[model samples]
Target: MAKLPNGLISFGKNANCTLELCPLEASILQYQPSIPGNGAIIGLFALSMLIHIIQGVRWRSWDFMICMVIGCVDEIIGYVGRIMLHSNPFSFAAFVIQVVCITTAPVFFCSAIYVMLSRTINYLDRSLSHFNPKFFVWFFIPIDIVSLILQAAGGALSATQSGSGNKLGVRISMAGLILQVVTLVIFVALFIDYVVRYVRKSTARPLQSRMKLFLSFLFLSIVFVLVRCIYRIDELRDGYDGPLIRNEPLFMVLEAAMMVIAVFCLNVGHPGIVFDREPRNDAEMSYTYTGNTGAMLQPKLPSSSSE
Candidate 1:
C-alpha cells in the first residue's frame, strides 16, 4: 500500500481497491455521493435548459439563452460525476469532472445575469447608469473567464496529485471562489445604485406590474447565487478533506438547492418577457423634454386628421 505525504493512501487511476478491500474513510470524500439527490438535480437542470431553449428561440434572446443552456448542461454533467462517485467514491475521473464542472458552471450563469443588467440599463435609461451599459459585458465577462480558468486549473491539479499536493489545488480553487464572491458583491452594489439613480432621475411612469415582477425575480436570483458562492468558499477553505466538504447534506442544501432556486427564478423573470415586445413606430416613439423638470412627454400616436 503506497501512502502519500499526507498519510493517506495513494488511490490514483491504477489503484486497485474496492469498498470491501479498503475502509470508506480512505476515499477522498470518505462517503459515497447520494445518487438520488444528484439525479434529481440533473432532472431539474435539464428541464430548465429545455425551457430556456424554447424561450430564447421565441424571443430571439440568443445570448442569454445560450449562456443559460450551457450553464445548465455543465450542472447536469457535474451532478452526473457525483452519481459516478456514488458507485466508486475513489474514482479520480469522477472527482475531476464534478469539481471542474460544478465550480465553473456558475460563471456562465453570472455572465448571463451580467448581460441582462446591461440590457435592463439600456431599456430603462442608460444616462442614469454610472457606466456605459456595454462596460458590464466587457468587464464582468472577462473576470468570469479568469475565475473559470483558475477553478478548472485547480481541479486538474488536484486530480493529478495525491495527499498534501491537493492543498495547493484547493487553495487555487478557493482563490477563484473568493474572486467570484467579490465580483457578485460588486455587481449587486452597482445594480442597486443604478436602480436608485433611475428612480430619482427619471420622470418616466412607474414600472408596469410585469416589469416589477421581472426585476424582483432577477434580483432574487442574484442573491441566491451569491449565497451559494459564499457557501462554496467556506466549504473549500479547509481543503478537500475538510468537514464541510464531507458534509453531503450541506452540499445538497447550499449548492444544489440554491442553484435550483436561482435557475427557476430566472425562468420566471426571463428578460425576453418584457423586452421582446413589438417596437413602437417612430411617430409614436418621439420624446419632448420638459426643460429642467427631468420630465418628457410620453410617446403616443397622432390623432386622426378628420378629428
Candidate 2:
C-alpha cells in the first residue's frame, strides 16, 4: 500500500492533512469513492441533458428548458469531479468542483419550478392565487439565490481548509440547507393552497388531462426535492465528519437518486400542458374543472335579442 506525504493525515479525523497523506488503514469513505456510482450519475445527467433539450424544443418551454439544461450540466460536472476524487482523493480541484456545482445546481431547478408554478397559476385562474403569478417568480427565486450564494461560499470555505475542519463553513452550509428547507416548505404550502382554492372555486369546471398530469407530477417533484433537502440538512448538521456526510449509500439515495427523479418527473409532467394552448374565442376560454372529474365548464354569456 502506498503512503501519503509526510505531515498529512488521510482520514477526515485530521482535516488539516490531505486525503492522500492518510495510511491504508484510513476509512474507505475518507479516501476511496465508488467509481461506478459516480459514473452512473454522470451518465444519467447526460441523458437528462439530451431529454431536456428535446422537451424544450418540442414544447417551446424556453425557461424550463434553460433551467434543466444548466442543472444537468452542473450535475455532470459535479460527478466528473467525483470521478477525479475517486482517482486521487487529495485533489482539491475535484473537491471544489463537486462541492460548488452540485451544491448550487438545484437552485436552477427551483427556479424552473417557480416559473412553472406561476404559469400554472395564470393558466388556471390568476384570481385563484393570493398573489400574482409573477410574485412567486420574484419572491422565491431571490430566496433561492441567497441560499445558493451561502452554500457556494460555505462549500468553498470548507474545501480550501486544512485539517480539523472549518467550523464556520459547516455552520454556514447548514444554515443554507435549513433556509432552503424553509423556503420549500413555504412554497409547497402556498402551492397546495392555490390548488385547493382553484379546485373548490372552479367546481363546475373540469380539468384537462394535461393539466391534471402537470399537477400530479409537479406535486411529486416538490415532495422529492423536499425529502432530499431534509436529508441534506441532517447530513450537514453533523458537519464534515458527521455520519450522514460520510455515508456513501445514503448520499447516493438521498442526493443523487432523489434529484434524478425530481428532474425526470418535471420532464414528464411538463408545464407545456398548460402553455401549449391555442387562442380561442371568449365562448371557448379554458377553465379547469374541480374534484376528480375531467370536465370543462362551458362559458356563460348573456342572451342576445334579435328584432
Candidate 3:
C-alpha cells in the first residue's frame, strides 16, 4: 500500500496531489470526541422540507415542491456524512459525502428562486418591473448551473488527491457561493422594485392575509439562504483546514438552520392558500387544485378576494 505525504490523503508517490485531498490522520482527535452537530440540525430541516413538500404538492406548487425536495435530500446526505464523522473524523468517504452534499444543495434553492420570478412576472404587471423575469431564468439560472458543476467537480477532483488539496475544493465551492450571492442580490432588488410599484398602483390587487403568510415564509427562506451562503463564504476564507472552515457548530446554526427554516417558509407561502377560494374575474385566476386547465392566472383587480 502507498503512503500519503504530509497534510495529504488518498495520494502516494504516483497519485495526483493537486486536486484529490483528504483529511490527515494526524489531525484526527482520537483522544477527544469529534462530536458533530450537523446531523441533528440537518435532520430537523429535512423534516421541515418533507412537510412543506407535501403541502406544495397538494397545492400544486410544483416549483416549490421540487425545490424543497431537492434541498432536503442534499442536506440529509450531507448530515449522514457528518454522522460518519462522529464515527471516524478522518474517514475520507465521510468527508466527501459532507462536502459534495452541502456544496450543491443551494443550487436547488436558486432554481426555485428562478421559478418564482417567472410566476411573479405572470402575476403582476411585468411592464412595471425594471427587467423581465425571464432574464433571471435565462441568465442567473445558467450561471447557477455552472456554479454547481464547478463545485461538484472540484470536490470530486480534490477527493481523489491527497493532502490539503482539499483547499482547492473549498475554493471552487466558495466561487459558487459568491456567484449565488451576487445573483440573489440582483433578484431581491428586482422583486422589491415590483413590490413598490404594485403598492403604488391604483389598480393593485389587495393582498389576502393567507398570501401574506406565504410571502412571509418565502421571505424568511430567502433571508436564511442568504445568511447560510454568507456563512459558507466566510468559513472558506482560509481554505479547507482553516480554523473557521471546520467548525461544526457554526454549520449547524447558519447552514442547516437556514435551510430547515426555509422549508417551513414554503409550507406557509404555498400557492394553495393564495389561490384556492379566492374569487377573480376569470376562473383561470384561481388556483386550480383540481387540475383545471383554466387555472392560469392573469394580473387584474382581485374579485371578492379572501386572503
Candidate 4:
C-alpha cells in the first residue's frame, strides 16, 4: 500500500503500519467505538423519529414534528457514523458525519422548543409575556440558525484538518458550543420569567391537567439539553486530543444519552397536548388586563368542532 513519505499513517489501504504504527495519541479513535453504545443510540433515535412522525400526523402538528424528526434523524446518522468508526477507525468520512450531524442536531430541537413556547404564549395570555409570540419565533430561531451554522462550519474544518495538530478548528467549534449554551440559558430565563408572571398575576382560572404536564416535561427537556450543551463546551474546550474527548463512555453518556432523553421528553411533552383545540380568531382571542386586580380575562373556550 502507498504510504506517506514521512512514515505518516496511510489511509484507505491496509498496511503493516495500521494501528501499530499509529500511536493512540495520533489517532482520534484511540479505541474502537463502542458497538453496543452506538447501536443503542442509533436504535433509540430511530424509534423516537418514528414516534414523532405518528404523533405529528395524529395531532397535525406539522412544524414541530418536522423539527423533531430532523433532529432525531441527524442523531441516527451520527451514531451510524460511530458504528462505521468501529469498523474503520481511520475513516475520515465517518468522523466528519458524526461531528457535523451530532453537533448541529440540537439546533432543530431548539427550534421546535421555541415554536412551542410561542404557541403556548398565544394559547395563554399574551399580555403576560414581555414580547409577542411571534417575537420569540423570529428572534430565537435566527440565533439558533447562527449557532448551527457556526457549529457545522467548525465541525467541517476540524474533520478536514484532523491529525494535523490544528487548534483553529477546535476554537471555532468551542465558540459555537459556547454561544449555544448562552442562548439556551437566556431562553430558560425568559421561559421561567413568563411562567412566574403568568402564575402570580393571573386570576385563578381552571387550567387543564394536560397543560400542567406539557409545561413540566417541556421544562425537563430544556434542562436536559442545557446540561448536555454545558458538557459539550467542556469537552471541546481542550480540542480533539483532550482527555475528555478520548473517553468514549463519557461521550456516550453526556452526548448521546442526554439527547435521547431530551427528545423522548419532548415526545411526552408534545405541543399537541395543549394545542389540540383550534385557536380562536384574533378578535375573540384578545385579552383585556384589569389593573384593579392584576388579572386578565380568560380566553374563550374552544368550540365543539375543535373538541
Top candidate by TM-score? 1
| Candidate 3: tens digits of C-alpha lDDT, residues 1-307 | 1345674543223333332253433332221123445646666866778776677767676666777688778878887877775655556677678778887887787677666665555554566766765666788778878878877877666555555666676677778788888878877777667777877987766665775675667677778888988888897786654565556556667877787776666666765675454444233454322331123454444478677
Backbone Cα, N, C clashes tallied per candidate: 0, 9, 9, 0
lDDT of 4 by residue, 68-141 (tens): 99999888888889898776677777878888999999889988887766777666667788887788888888
Q: Give one digit per residue, the lDDT tens place, for model 1 in 1-307.
A: 3343434443676655567566777787888999888999999999999998999888777888898999999999999999998887877788889989998898898888887777767666777888888888788989998998888888777667766777888888888888888988888899889888877764654565666777899899999999999999899887776799889999999999999899989999998776754234334563332221122233444556884
Better of 2 and 4 by TM-score: 4
Ranking by lDDT: 1, 4, 2, 3
User: Residue 290 of model 4: what lDDT?
Assistant: 24
| Candidate 2 structure quality by residue, lDDT tens digits, 1-307 | 1345556645333434444445423432464568999899888878877988997888677778898899889888998888887776656677778878888788788888877667767656677778877788789989988998898888787766644457778777778878888988888899889888877873424566777888898888888888888898787786776777677788899999999888989888877655664323345553433211121223434447777
Q: Estimate each model's TM-score.
A: 0.88, 0.84, 0.79, 0.85
- Candidate 2 wrongly placed segments (more than 4 Å): 1-5, 9-21, 24-28, 162-165, 202-204, 278-307
In lDDT terms, which candidate is top?
1
lDDT of 4 at 142: 93
Return the lDDT, model 4, position 260. Answer: 94
Candidate lDDT values, in order? 0.80, 0.74, 0.65, 0.77
Ordered from best to worst TM-score, the candidate numbers read 1, 4, 2, 3
